[model samples]
Each structure stands twice: as structure tokens, then as C-alpha cells.
Target: MPIEIHQSDPQSYAVAADFLNVADVEVVSLQHEFGIFGGNAGDHILELVQRLRTPLVTTLHTVLAAPDEAQRRVMNALIRSSARLVVMAEKGRQILQTVYEVPNEQIAVIPHGVPDRPFLDPAMAKHDLGLADRTLLMTFGLLGPGKGIETAIHALPALVRNHPKLIYMVVGATHPNLVRHEGERYRDSLVALAADLGVSDHVLFVDEYLSIEDLLKYLTACDIYVSPYPNAAQITSGTLAYAVALGKAVVSTPFWHAQELLSDGCGMLFSFGEADALSTAVAQLIEDDSLRSAMRTRAYARGREMVWPSVAEQYLDVFSKVRFERRSAGAMVIPFPASVGEHDRLPPVSTTHLASLTDGVGLVQHTKFAVPDRRHGYCLDDNARALLVMSELAGLVPLTPQEDQMTLT
Candidate 1:
């Protein structure tokens, strides 16, 4: 169903809620970004989620380190309402725990998913694009001021002096939001900057939103991928993820996502808006074949874990767990006489499920109903706590044979 919620109209949220209630969806997966919604700090979403009849699993695209009062209020309400939360990076998980006081169990750190593409020689890809003679350096995504394309343009003059065949390709159209307000001013400024620097011949702008197939082709053709985004707080970048998964040698600024994904020699990082530094890093990668090849290999190896099939499985696991919990919570309710106190009506806890989760290594991190899911693997943090609990239980009471087996495992 394609029910639309008007961004600025508060009542549209109520209508959306009503539509979803009748849509027969067992679960709702919301892709959340603060700016995409309306009202003060996106409070409009709270109304929709509050009225939702289906279980909500929110994937947070941006997690601010420090939010203002209104943002904090809205975030807290959303967290309280959601059945589960998903963030792309560990830094976002840290912010949710320390800054928002969200519990660790509520947040799932699934990486930004990317297509699984085999590594290809850039020269062959460049031949298909009819640019085999030139060395391509590319940056893609919606064009906007925050993307810092002018910095890349400024660096081109220095780069072109040594590698005369180098061409800087700025792919994608101007961002719709930027076009709505500022019209093409940011993109024009970049073009004029390149012209002023006398490197206009070296810059190519593919001004359209590309389909996935075309985007992959462009990414494969590029010798180096550049991300000059000035913002350090950005929590996710699908383009950056795609580049890494395709085994491109990436040169990026130290944003939150880039810093984490590019660590351990996967890619090179330069300071934000530093033309000389960006130029130097790109030049080094271009000059050293062994270093560039090694970086690509490491990046491709790490990306195997982030490919679409693996990411999809992780998402399905989260959905299954949340749906089961919702159903279990609904089934636990029973009508009692008014004289019955809340404490007296509580149900006894069972260790059956706990035992099922434990294995030879440790407790599996997640489950689908009673079945343990090994896809998530075991965490040392969880194992340490399990050990502590077993130790405490042994001191207080005699361990059952089954419990002894668990401790041994």
C-alpha cells in the first residue's frame, strides 16, 4: 500500500495511522532521519508511531551526539514506543546507550547493506565507459554544499600536474531539497571553482540520479572513490558502503561511518576541507600499486560481512524476534478480579528458554522463538555476565546436573 503522509500537515499522520491499521502488516520497518519528518524536531512521527497498531522496528539513519531539548524529548518518546531500534554503526549504538540511556538489548548494530559485486579491474570497467585512457576519481550521491565538492575541485589542479590523465567525476544530480530552496547554486559554484582553477577539462559531472546498475558501473570504473563530506557527525553513507563492497580504493574525510569502516588499512582518510591533504592521499594511492591493491583487498574482505544476503538475514532475525515478543506479550494478559494486586497476578519466570540459548561457546545473542540463532554469534560481554550469574548461583545453592553442564560449556 502506498499511503502518503503529507510532511507539514499534522492530521495526515492520523490518517496514515488509520491506513496502516487496516493494511494488515504484522510489522512496520521505519527508515528514520530527523529532517525527513515535519514539526518541531520531527514530533509529527511520534503521533503516527503512538497510534500504530503494528509493531515498529525503526532503523535510525542519524544519531546525533548532542541533541537539543526538543530532539531529546522526541527521541526518548520514539525509543519508548518502538519494539526495536536499529543503527548502522557502533558509534550510533554508543550514543544511544550513553546519551539517550537506551538499553543495550533494544539496539541492533546492523551495517548499511550493499550489493555483492565481484572485484573487477578498473581498466576493463573504464574501457566499457569509453574512458580507458584516463584515470578516474569519483564522488557520488545527491549534490549539496555539505558534500564539499569544491574541495575536490580545488585539489584537482595539484593532482592533474602529476597525473595528466586524471579525471574527477562528480556523479548524481543536485539534492532535491537543495534545489527546492537554493536552486543549483551549490553545484554551479563547484563548476565555477573548477573553471577558475583551470581544471575544467579534468572535471566531469553526471547530473542525474542513477539506477543501481549504472551506479555500480560508475563505481567499478573509478580508480579511486572520494568522499569529501564536511560533516563529522554523519552516521551513514550508502555510497561509501557501495564503494567499499565493490573493492574501490576509497579516500574520505573522517566522518563517523568512514572512521569506523575505513579503519585497519581498509581506506585512506584526510581532514575535512583540506585540499592539499586530499590531493596527497589520492596521489599516494594512485602512485603505489601494491598499497592500493592491499587496501582494496582488505576492504573487499571486510565487505563480505556487509553484503545484502547477510544483512537481509540479520534484519529478518530482528523482525522475527520482535514479532514473537509482541505476540508473547499479548498472550500473557489475563483478566483478574479487582481485588487481585499487580504483584499477586505476576507470572513465574522459566529458565527453559535460557537453557536453550546456551551452547558450547556461550549464549547465542538472538533467537527465533525457542530456537537459538547462531548467525549473530556469541559476544564476550554476554558470556562474562553468564559466568557471573552461574558463579553467584553456585555459592547460594547446589547446581542441577543440567546447570553443571551449562557451566562446563
Candidate 2:
């Protein structure tokens, strides 16, 4: 399906409703991080959703457990605007329902998606990465404070002593956003801490943005993937999800997303900032090969449900429900006003114009009366309208492939 990209400025809410006027656009998929901390971007998103005539599906990137009055109001407005809400964890769903008063039916729990990759043996990967005979432990992704990397580094000193052959690889560069404002302060601090702990040689910092191919190579080589993020409210971690999906044993802090993904023997989790617990979790997994292998198998099996294809299908299901509801609503005839004339009610809101406006791809957004305008592009709104009209009239009109895609969304 061909996708139309409409760019909207994040800081401005003035033109939030303009996109709603675009033709043939059936549904809007919004990614939201509800906050004013970063230039009131979330407010802009909420404004857009409020003005949208098409159905909206919002994937909330952050779900605050203890939100303030303003935050709560914004989240409530967002939930109301959205036809369906996608959260990456069940914990996030609970937070929305309990804290924000969102209906249980309004939320869909979809796991963070990961790419499908063939499982590679860690020993083979270690050899390929030139770390022969060494026990590899790793944590990766853009670096910044609150990542709890220092806690992971602090734990390393004791870990290296128990297993002399162990090497901890701190992968990826400083987070680009953090670098723009804070320079290298966080990375320098982690490096300094590793030096102070006398584990500098054991801790390898690979400071560069890794390509997906290279990242998977490094992930495949690790005996255990550690995500020592300290934030308890964190609802999603793509890095952690990727490691789990690739069949690697994981040791992570008990953040909300981790609590969900790591449950049921899929991975090990420790309390936030607990280096002793973190090290113990890693050491236990490292010592027991059978247990580690079991974790990898379980994680990989669970990950299959969250792969991109699976996630896409789940999204389609939500979109279909929204489409059906809209169609049923449109099919109902509104009561005529007391001032209505006989001529106005003669046509009975027929779908004739909608049928005339459609072509092979879908219904065009703009037209000169009943004639289709080719210059204007196909849109989700018009396509959705066409679908509703067609559905109400049964098989009198059939939806094109593009129209079908729009209605499904």
C-alpha cells in the first residue's frame, strides 16, 4: 500500500485540524510522549487528535504512574480522542485505566516489536567477533544518564573477580539528544567510575552508533544482555526487546516493561540501582548454562508474538473494529429538522457521488462536483467515507484495494 506522509510541526498546535480535511485518509496513527517538558509536543499531538475526523490510534510512548493534574488532563483528552490506544505492556494498560480513567476496552496491549532473526550460538558469535574463549556480557543503546550504566559498571568489579575470563562491553555512543545539550558528561562519568573500580580493562566501551547488522552481531555474541535502566516508570525498551527476541538471556532492572517481558522465566530482573542483585542475576545465569539456555528459549518463544508481522495484524484488528463502528453509525439516518424542505430530503443522502469519485486505487480527496479530480491524491478520509457508504449499501459498491486498506486502518 502507498502511504502518504504528512509532516506536522511538533511545537505548534495551530494547524492541528487541517489534516482532517484531507481526502481519503481513513485513520491516523499517532505516537505520543505526553509532556510539555520538551516544547509542549504532547499538547500539539493531543490538539491534532482532537480535530481529527478520521479514527485515531495512539501509541503512548510514556505512561506516567503518578501524573500531575495537567498531565492527567492531557492524557485523558488523548484517550478520548483515540478510537483505540496501543500500549507496549499490560502494566501500561493498568496505569491508563486506574490512573487516567480510560476504559478497559479502549486499550490494546501490544508488545514492543522486534525484527525476526535466526538464533546464533553465543560461542560461535564470540569467536566471530574476535573475543575467543572469553565470556561476553553486554548492554547497548544510546548512552545517557538514568541508564544506570554506573550501577552495571560498579557490579563488574566483583563479577570479573569471580569469572576471570569475563568481559563487559558497553556498546553505542552517547545519546544524540543528550550530546546536543549535555555534551559527554554521562559517558565520561561512566568511564571514570569504571577506572576507579579498577575494571577498565574488563569493561570495553564501543562508542559509536551501530548499524542493525552490527548490533545483531554484538547481541548474538553476548552470554547475557544487561539492561540496567533505573527508571521504574519506563514502559518500553526496544534494546531489551531485541535481545529477548534474538534468544539471548537477559538481566534487567525491574522497570515496568521489563517486569512484563521478563516474567515467567523469560529473563531475570533485579531492583533498580541494586548492583548486588544485578551482578548476582548475571552471575547465576552465567554459571548455570542450562538455566541460561532455558531463558533464551522462553524469551525467543515469547518474542514471536511481538514480531512486526504479528504487531501489524493486531493493529489491523483494531482498525477493522473502528471502521465497522463508523460504518454502522453512518448508515443510521438522522431525524429531519422541523424546517427541512421536501427537495432536501428527496435524494436521501445517496452514495452516488462517492461511487463516482472512486477509481482503481481509492476515492480521491477532492473533486469538481460529481466528477473525480485526478490531480488531488487519494486520502484516508475519502477512502473511509467510501468504505462506510459501500458497506451500508451492501454489495451495490465494492471497495478497491486501497479503499480496503484505508477501512482496515
Candidate 3:
């Protein structure tokens, strides 16, 4: 459903290869390049998903449109497929539903969950991380345009005058593509803005991929977590979960993610895209330690409910529901009826595309230059290719090459 990035491993790749081999359904993940996929394997999954003899489910991990053309094509293909689309936030569901016009029933929302761990004492964590002297305010995520760092930086100018000891930890490296596309221009812009605001020295830029332990140490060290997201369609953010799990006071924009996460004093929210309001929230947290403590307590409770096992079980339940529906319907494969076939011609695709739907290891139909590859695989790209080679594993659309493309039923 989304990118699963692997930085290293030849043998570690086996786990994914093994998964695709036995999975009851073909799972296609979009956004192959976020270091989520091994290599070209993600692309191969798109071709291989056609051969799976079971249900197909896709997770559009990120907003897929414009900028990334190839990924956008894959996302469109996923939507066009019989596979169901899984989104992470209600707002994301709204985007695909109201804006993209995907059927409401076709999309699902399941928030990302964190581990249910006993939170480290904030004092202990701060001391351990050498951050004891200062109040920590953090924004952790791959820094990018939609990430809302600018708003966070702008809010900081006013915030620092009142709470001089406060340190803003800017976690996460600039996104790889962003660096490639603009050559550290975005990073320079952020640095300049911080400098202009006279809080550049207070901003800590940890410019490396943090390991799990490093991540936890820094996460636990924070006194407060800030997610100043400007764009609201972002489906889910793992940092948001991590913050709540650690019981840190959270101050965030009232985006859909915050709506789902900021419930139960787990944190506080400000108006969307308002820097001054964000400043006010931070000032409130800093000025009132009692309020911060109360928020921290509630944040941990929310995190406890979001542990990975619990969240993962939700997906398992969804899978069970999908499987049960197929079984009760008495057929594993249900065609999109000929009556709805006219809808395929209602709209036009920019290019001629091919799709092959199947159940079991069979070529149910055939047309054009495309044929089903017959091996269902994991969606991560690079690993998909390298892993596929090691695993040593393994369609047809219809009459007239199925030229009518945009079909929704």
C-alpha cells in the first residue's frame, strides 16, 4: 500500500521476497523512489500484480499527483484496478473521494500506530541526550515544502523572545529528491529564514539518517512536539505517533492528522496555517508547566492505544472482511459487469494503458501487447527486483485491447 524503503541488505531482502510468494493478495505500493523500494522491483510488482489469484489491495502511501509522473501513473493504475485503495487519514480519504472522485466505498482510512512503551521520564531522556539545559521543541519528518517548516520557523521568532532557553530541534534530512532537484536550495532557504529571525543558533539541524535508538533518544528527549504542517492531505505521520507515544506536549496545526491524533488532550491544536496561533500555543505550553504536564499524560494514553500490534490488527481485520466478502459472494473473482463497461468509455486516458484482472493462476482474458506475468510480489521497487531474482519466482485485459480506460463503478 505504500513505500517500504530498505537502505541496506541482500539477505534482508529475502523477507519481502518470501512475503510476495505466499501473500493471499497482491499488494501494490506507490512511491517507489522514497528509498522505500529496493530498486526497480516496485515497478515489476505493478506488472506482476496482474497474475495473483486473489484479491488486490493498494495503499497510496503519499499524495500522488503532478511532480512524480511515473508514480502518478502507477497510482492511477492502482485506482483503476479492482484492488481497494487504503489511505491513512480521513482527509486523505476526502481528497481521493471528493476531489479525485474515487468512490467512497473504494477507499479506507487506518491511522498509523506506534509501540505502547512505558515512556521514559522526560528529565532522564533530556539529560541522556545532552539537552537538559534547554526546553526542546521538535518537528521531525522529512523536511519538505508541504512539511510546514517555514511556518514553524516563522512562529519561532516570536516564541524565542519569551522562552529564551527553548531549542528547536529540526529533525530529518532534507528529502533526497528535493536536494537533487534544487541542490540544497530549500535547506539554504530554511537556514536563511532562521538566521533572519535571529533564531538560527537555537535551531539544531541533525543532518543524517537517525537509527532506531537515536530516534527514540531524541524523541524521548523532547519536552514538546510541533507538527506545523501547511498541507492537510498528508495521510499519516509516524512522528506524530512517536510524540504521543513518548507523552510529549504536542502543538500542531488542526489538520486531519491532528484531528485524529489530537483527541483526548493528547495535545493541542491551532488554526490551520496560522503561525501566530502556533506561537500562542507554544507560549501557552511554555508558560504553564501544569498544562504541559496534563497534555503529556493524555498524550501517552492516546499513544498506548496506537501501538503497532493494535494498529496492525486493524489491517488484519480489514483483510478478513475483504476475504469474507469474497467467500460469501461465492466467487473469488467478480467482474465489473458489462453494464458498467460503458463507463470505461465515459472518460479518456491520456495514453493507451493495459490492465488484466485475475483470480487463481489463470489468464482470464487477453488483449494488446500485455500478458499477465503470473507472480504476485511486494511493492517496494529496488528490493522488488533484487529480491525477485533471489526468490526465483514467477495477464490479459479483454477484447479490442480494452481501449476505454477511465472506468469507475
Candidate 4:
């Protein structure tokens, strides 16, 4: 179905409600940011969610560890109004459960999506980027306070001491929100820090926003990717996710998302805002070829689950589940097939079909020609049909005494 765009000013409640009403959307899907909830804007979203008759599915961008009263109220109300809530990480789901007391069933874990790209060797990628001699370390995002780019810069002197050919590339403009408020103070601070540390020559800042192709090029060229974000509660990091997906050896601060993704040899984690720890983590990967290769392999394997196609399928699954639940909630009948009764008058069906259709679990839902197709996965409807057929066959097959007792029990 084609979706229509309905724009509204979030700061104004009447405007938002008017746009929502005009759309008459089946599902009110929201991409929420907790920071936007600081003013009365949060209430506007909550109000819209409540007033709209449509089902709601919210993809939460920021799941705060500590929420104040208004924040909690808004988040709780959003959860109550939404048919399902989508979070990018298991840690985000856990926080919602423990902190907001949201029901487990209402929450869905869909990883932040990454573009599918063929894995390329960093050396080959670097040759293309004209940085074949440099061991590149990078972090790219719209920069602002709390990104902890300063920590990465501070760590550069030590990293440069061990590997003089290392270059730390900070690829992004100052975040628009931060620029609006602080106007490059954070970027200037980072530049000053680099200069003071005498590693100014080694740090490269590509101060332009990258297109997806450009971003992927830079990501493919890096020896190691570093996310030095300072916030422990931070739930999503697209930059880190991309690097991990591309199989770059990642060293990151222990933010919620990083801790979850980088565990068990996938990548290394250091304490938040600890430049020394960042340096050591990077040094370990730099010094050991085998260890870095292993981490890269593990990172690549784990990232396969989060590629765009897989993530899109997961989103579709959630949408299907929510749509089914909404439609079935008011339904009175189970809607079984009418042809089921005709099986009695016709000659008995051969078990050959059933035998071919059976898997270790149960009967499969789909078929390719005469053969079972398991690619679409199992369905309860098909399994239910199998159970009904088995029950009818029970009369002809006499059960032994022990078998009879087990069946009864």
C-alpha cells in the first residue's frame, strides 16, 4: 500500500491532531526521541496516540535509563497506546521492562538496520581511498557534546606513539541541534585538544556529512572502528553498528548498545570517557594480527543477523502480528476451512503427501511443486491441521496399555 505524507508541527497539539485526523491511518508509526519530550511536545505525541483510533507502533530511538516523572509518564502512556513498541536492542527492551514496567509481549527487538555490502579487505579498501600506508581509525556521526570524540583524540598521542602511521579520522559536521545551540564549541574543543596533545597532525576531520556510498567507502577503508561515546545509557549508535556489520575490528565505550553487540570476542569495550582504556583497546587490536582477524570474523558473523534484508523481514513480521491481533480482537469465529468436511465423503487422502511435508518439528506451511518449502517458516494453522488429521487416524490404530496411559495422561 502506498502511504500518504501528513506533516504537522509537533510543538502544536491542534496542528498534530488535525493532521492525524486527516490521514485516518491504519497504524500510527512513530520514531520517538526522548530528548524531544523535554517540553510539552511529549504530551502532544501522547495525546495524539491516545486520541487516534488507529493502531500505533512506535520505534523508540532513545530509551533513557533514568527518566523523570514527565518522561516516565509520556513513555508509559505511549506504550499503553501503542499496539507494539519496537526497540533496536535487547538492552533497550530490558530498560523498558525494568524501568517503565512495560509488558514483555508489547516490546519487539529489531536491530538497527545496516546496508548489505560484500566484505572487502581493509588494505584493498585503503588503496582505493588513497590511504594505503595509514592504519586508519575512525568514528562518523553528526558530532556534538557527549560524543566523546575528545577522548578518542586524547588517546591518539599514545596510539601514535605505538604506530606512527595511525590516522584518526573524525568524519562528520557538527550536529545541527548542537550547532543551533552551542555553535561549534564542541568541535573547537576537540581540535584544541588534538593540537595541545601534539597529535594535531595525525587527526583528520572530514567536516562534511557523508552520503551512504561515501560512508560505506570510509567504513571499508578503516583498520579499526572506534565509538568513544561518553554516555553509558545511550541505546543506539548507527556508526558503531555499521562498522561492526562491515567486519571492522571495533573498540567502543561501554554504552548499552555497544555492550550488547560487542560481547564474547565480537569487539572490545572500554569504560566511558576513559581515553587510556580506549588507547589500550585499540593497541591490542593493532598489535595482534590473529586476535584482530578473529574479532573481525566474529563481528562479521554477528552482523549478518542485522543486515537490511533480515531487519526488514523482522519488521514485516511484527507488522503482520499487530495487524492480525487488531483484526482478530473483535472477530467471533475461528475461520476454519470449509473444505475440511468434504474429506470424509471423498476417498481417504494418502499419507505420502503428509510424509513428504513433515519436518522434525511438524508439517510445513508452504510447498515448492510437490516438495515442502521450509523457507517461509512454520505456521500454527498448518500444525493445527496436522493435529486434526492425526486425531481422526487414532481410531484405526490401537494403542498398547502403556501407550494408552501415556496418551490419557
Candidate 5:
């Protein structure tokens, strides 16, 4: 099977790769945030993707405001070139439609996926993880001020004093590149806040990034998963997805996906930016064991229907339709192996470049709260592609030779 793709970032590719079942994938170097950010786009990348013989089906990862004119120009061209726009939530699609003027008909909102886990059997998980005796409340993600760890921390003292047996586990550290964005300052701040709250002993902080297995182990042991994030749109929450998959009761301030998923019975929501409200809702769930039980049951059922397999189908369907329309309208079709052999070019970014978006990224804001997610260790999306090249040289992800067949319509 052949589904030719040319993505700009590695983290996005990693999530996208799981849904695709194919042997030959041609990656253009656009995914370079972590690989090698020269503070600019590389010509090898442009030549790699621009020469595509088949129309590319791309997912616009963000709406940036950058100073790099070249990046902006490329982004503009790329959006126009895509067969269809694929996003994880409707808000992302709306951003494209209202802000970028991407026609509403051309976008599809397919939320991210959560892998199957031992969520349905809490008793067995508790026994396996030795959490049978304690009430485990957990929150996992890149630890930054925007993540609202402080809010959860403040809420924790309330939780623990009422039920002293509770424990909260925070899982991963911020991305290495984000260190440029805001370093260990956020992590250090959380540590200090916990100490001041005097819940230092009760709160477990693991500084190293956790593997998926390590993450799952904690999920299995958790009774409640919280997303105290001030900004919801920083990115969709895999933490939330994982918790929902296992059916753990979720207590979160309102975020886009949270609002959508919470109502389905897997979790509950509190008003965003209000710590007292956040605290009260969390307290309610902890004291009421029956509600937690019901939320868990619904979450598992939702996960079966919305996880990667189903989400991938929606993507595939959108790509098929959009590609058909473009082809019908005489959009040139790029064949496999759109050569990277000779082209040396850099399409200038917009006067308003996107990479600059980090300056005032509309944080997804709970009060003045102070952040794949895999530890593949790429600096930005770029680092992953470089690693891909290295892996092929080292034979990490070995290719099994096979033929690919594509039908335009």
C-alpha cells in the first residue's frame, strides 16, 4: 500500500504515522524544529516537497505569526496546495476558515487517538500497580507555568486534608527546544509551589520524560486525571485522551476538546481560570466514588469509537474527496519520487512568519496560571526527520520492500 506524505514537523508525523499502514513513505524535510533549526527553512526541504509528483495531503499544525517572510510564504503556499485541511478539533478548523479563509467545506475536525489500555478493569490495575490501598489522583504533561500545575497544587492541599491518603503524579518535563521558550523555570516553580503548599511529600515529581509504557503504568494506577491548563489550545491533550481511554474520572478547566469529551460521560468540567471552581469540582469527584465509576465506563466506550483507527478513516476520507476535487479542477498530480536531486530553493516566508507565533501564542488562559509527545528527542519537528535519516542509516525502523498502488479518485 502506498500513501505518499510530506510533513513539516516530526512530532506531528509520529502521531500521523500510527494511523497509516504502508511500507514506502517519502518524507520531505519540513519537520525540522528539533532536527536542525538554522533559524530558517532549509532548501533541501522545499525542493523535497515542492517537487511532489502527487498532490500532498497536509495538516497545518499551527497558525503562526513569524518575521520570517520565507516561512510565511511557504505556509501560505502549502495551505493552498493541500488536498484538504485535517485538524484534531473544530476550533483548529475554525481558525483556518475564519482567520486564514480556508473554505469551511475543505476542513475536517478529527480528534487525536488514545491507544487501548487496561482502563476498563480498575480493580485489576490497582492490584497490579499496588494502588489498591491509596486514592491516586494524577496529572501528566510537559511541566510549564501555563499548565496550571500551581492550581492543581493549591487544590491538592484541599484534597489531601480532606482525604490525606491522596497522591498526585506529574509525568513529563518540557520539550528541550521549549527550554529556549521557557526553561526549567516552570519546573522549578512547580516544585517550589508544592513545597510552600506543604504537599511536597504527597506530590511526586518525575523530572525525566516518561516513555509511553511508563506513562501507561501511571495511568493504570490513577483514580483521577486532571488538566489544570490555563490555555487549552496549546495543543490537544494526549493526557486527557489516555485518561479517557482508561475511563479515569477527569477534572479539568474548560478547553475545546475537554468540553467535547467531558460531556460524553468519561469526565467532568469546571469553569476555566477559576481556581475555587476548579477546586470545588475536583473535590466533588473525589468524595463521590459512584460518579467516578460511571465516567470510567463511558470513557472506554468512547475511546473504542474515536481512537486512531476511526480517526484515521476520517482523515483518509477527507483526503480522498479533496484530492478528487483538486484533480477534477486540473490541479497537477505529483507522482511518487518528486525528485530532491537538483532543486535549490527557499520560498520566502510571509512578512508575518509563523515560527514567530511563540511570542504570544494565544495560550489555551485559566487565571494567570502558569505548559508526543514521545521522548524521540527531536528539538522541534525538524529533529525527528534528521533522526529518521539516521535511523535508516542505522536500520532502526527497517523497511520491508513492497509495492504501492494509488488511485486518484
Candidate 6:
């Protein structure tokens, strides 16, 4: 259901909240971005969330290192209202803990999801696109000033000087918001820049929004992928994630996501807006076939964890845990024995259930009656909880032979 974007619509918020409360959702996953909700810094979201009766799992799309007063207030309120907070990058988790003083347990770091695709030769895809002869360098996503497309365009002259057949592909249409106000002015300027730099033929702009199939096609066709975003605090980037997942050799600016994902030799990074650095990195990767191939191999290996299936399981785990916790919160509680002797009289807790749920990765997050639910996958939180329980149990009672074997496993 759609609610009108009015900054202070109390009745609208209340109605939306009431609808959701009665909708019988097990858990609500909210995607939080600053401008999406209506309010000063999206504070209007607080009104609706405050009225929610269902468990809330908020996925924060943007986590600012330095939030203004209004943004901070809205974020704090949202944090209080959410059962769990999700961020796509670890830097976001760090910022929430350090800057906002949020407890680490409240947050989960899940990478942005990417399509499951095979690592294929760029030549095959380039031939399919009728550009087999030229070396392709691509940057995709909605075209806007913040994308730093001009830097890539500026770097084109230096890149072309070495790889004479190089063609920089600027894919994707102008951002709707930018088009609404500026009417393709940003696209026009990039074109003009290319012309002025005397590399007009080397820069190609595919001015249209692309479907995932087409996006992947373009991605596969490119020999080198570049993300020149100038914002250092950009916490997540779906395009960047896709590039890494598709095994494309990447050269990106040091945005938060890039800094984390591109680390450990998975990809290359350059300072934001540094055209010379961008050109150098791209040239280095292009010149050294082994280096580029190794980067692709490492990136593909890392992408294994970020694939859609793995990410979906992670989300299911979070949702299942939230629902379980909510159900548990309202259930009857048994009072514990007061004295040590009283506790000693109680039978030792069985490790059977815990052992069944645990696999090599960690403890699975949920179970169906007596069976472990592997579809829900595992999470760090549950593993930590299991460790704590086992530590306490070891001190309280000697493990049975079977339990000892389970623990060793």
C-alpha cells in the first residue's frame, strides 16, 4: 500500500501503521533511505514504526559517518523501534557502534545480493555485443554527478594512449531525480567533456535503463569495471557488488563498500576523483593479463558468499529468529531455582538439540520441532550464543561421552 509523501501526516501514518499491525506479518523488513520516507530526515517513519505491533527488521541503505541533528534523531528512533538492524557493509556496523553507541548485538552485516552467473570470457560477451575488436571499460548505474562519470571520462585520454583500442562504456540512463530537475544536463556535460578531451569516439553512452539480463550482459562484455563514486561514506553499492560477483576486474574509488569488498587483492582502488590514479590503476590491470585474471579469480571466490541464494538464506535466518524471539517474549516463563542445591537436583540440559542444529559453518538459527532447519542458514549471533551456553554448561556438569564427541565435532 502506498502512503502519500506528506511531511507531517499523522492520520496517514496512523492508518498505515494500523493496516500493518492487522496484516498478520510475521516480521516487517523495512528498507531505510533518507529521502524515501516523507519528513525532515525521514523522521515521519518513526510515527509509523512506533505504532507497529509486528517485529521490525530494518535494512539501512545509507549509514552516514556524520549525520546532522535531524538525521541522527530519526535514525535513533528507528533503531529503538527495530528488532534488528541490517547494514550491507561492516563499516556501517562500525559507525553504528562507535558513533551512535548502538550495541553490536543489535546489528547484522549482510552483503548486498548479486545474481548467480558463471565466470565467462569477456571476448565472448563482447563479440555478442558486436564490439569484439575494441577493449571495453564500463561503468553502469543511473547517471548522475555523484557517480563521478566525468572522472572516468577525464581518465579516458590517458587510458586510450596505452590501449589504443580502448572504449569506455558509460551505461544506464540519467537518474530520474536528476532528469526531473536538470533534464539530462548531467549526461550532456559528460558528452561535452568527452568531446573537449578529444576522445569522443572512445566514450560510448548507452542512455537507457537496463533490466538485470541486459545489465549482466553489459557487465560480462566489459574487460574492466570502474566505480568512480566520489562519496567516501557510501555504505553500499549494488552495482559494485554485481561487478565483483560477476568476476570482473574492478577499479573503484575508496568508498566504504569498495574499501571493504575490494580489499585483500580482490580488486583495485583509487582515491575519489583522482583521474590520474584511476587511469593508472586501470592501465596496470589492462596491461598485466595475469594480474587481471588473478583479481577475477579472487573476486569470483569471494562472490560465492554474496550470491542470491546465500543472501536469501541469511534473510530467512534473520526473519525466523525475529519471529521466534517475538513468540518467545509472549510465552509463559518458568521461574529458576534459587539455590545451588536446588539447581543440582535438576537434570543436566541435553546437548542433542544444540548438536543437531550445528554444522561446520555454525549453529543453524531455527528448528522445526525436533529437526534443524538448514534453509534458515546460520548467523554469528546464534553461534556466539551457543558458545556462551556451552562454556557455562562445561563448568556446571561433566559432559557425557556422546556430548563430548558432539563438542569435538
Candidate 5: tens digits of C-alpha lDDT, residues 1-409 = 2333344544433433443324243322122221332224422234334445455666544444322676666555666656556666666776676656788776667777777664555556666866677777788877666778777888877777788878787888776867887777777877898999899977888677888887887788787888887865633566787788777888887877687777766677776577677668777887887887787788788777667788768767776675566454656777777547455444432312112221222212122212122222224444344334434433433332210000000
Q: What is the lDDT of candidate 6?
A: 0.89
Ranking by lDDT: 1, 6, 4, 2, 3, 5
* lDDT for each residue of candidate 1 in 296-323, tens digit (9 for 90 to 100): 9999998998999999999999999998
TM-score per candidate, in order?
0.79, 0.76, 0.65, 0.78, 0.65, 0.79
Q: Is candidate 2 or 4 superior in TM-score? A: 4
lDDT of 3 by residue, 1-409 (tens): 4224254544434445455547654342333233354333244444434444456566656654332665655556556754467776777787776656789887767666676668666778888878788988988877778888888888887888888888889888888878888877887888999999899878998776788678877888888899988866555777887888889899988766788888877788887789899989999998999999988988887777678898788777766666665453555666676755667553422223222432232222333346444454323453344333323311123323222221210
> Residue-wise lDDT of candidate 6 within 1-409, one digit each (tens)?
5444355676677687888888767898898999788779987888789999999999999998899999999989999999999999999999999988889888999999999999999999999999999899999998888898888999989888878899999999988989999898889888999999999999999999999999999999999999999879899999999999999999999998999999999999998899999999999998899999999999998998999999999999999888878885569867885777666586858788788787766788889997988888878787787888877888888978755654554
lDDT of 4: 0.83
Q: What RMSD, rounded to one decimal, does every model reach? A: 13.2, 13.1, 21.3, 10.6, 22.9, 11.2
Candidate 4, residue 144: Cα displacement in angstroms equals 0.9
Q: After superposition, how far is residue 378 of candidate 6 from its true place, in Å?
A: 43
User: Per-model C-alpha lDDT, please?
Assistant: 0.91, 0.82, 0.68, 0.83, 0.62, 0.89
Which number leads on lDDT? 1
Better of 2 and 3 by TM-score: 2
Task: For candidate 2, write residues 1-409 as lDDT tens digits.
Answer: 3333333454344354564547576777777775432334345456566777888888888888887777777788888888888999999889988888888988998888888888778988899989989999899988888788888998987799899889899999998878999899888888888889998888999999999999989998998999999878888989989999999999999888898898999999888899999889999998998999999999999889889999899988888887766664549757786765775443434545565666667778888877777888888876776677656645445556644554444
Candidate 4 residue pairs in clash (backbone atoms < 3 Å) = none
**Which candidate model has the greater lDDT, 2 or 5?**
2
Full-model lDDT, candidate 2: 0.82
Off by over 4 Å in 5: 1-49, 63-75, 178-183, 322-409
Runs in model 1 deviating more than 4 A are: 328-409
lDDT of 6 at 265: 97
lDDT of 6 at 64: 84
- C-alpha RMSD between model 2 and the true structure: 13.1
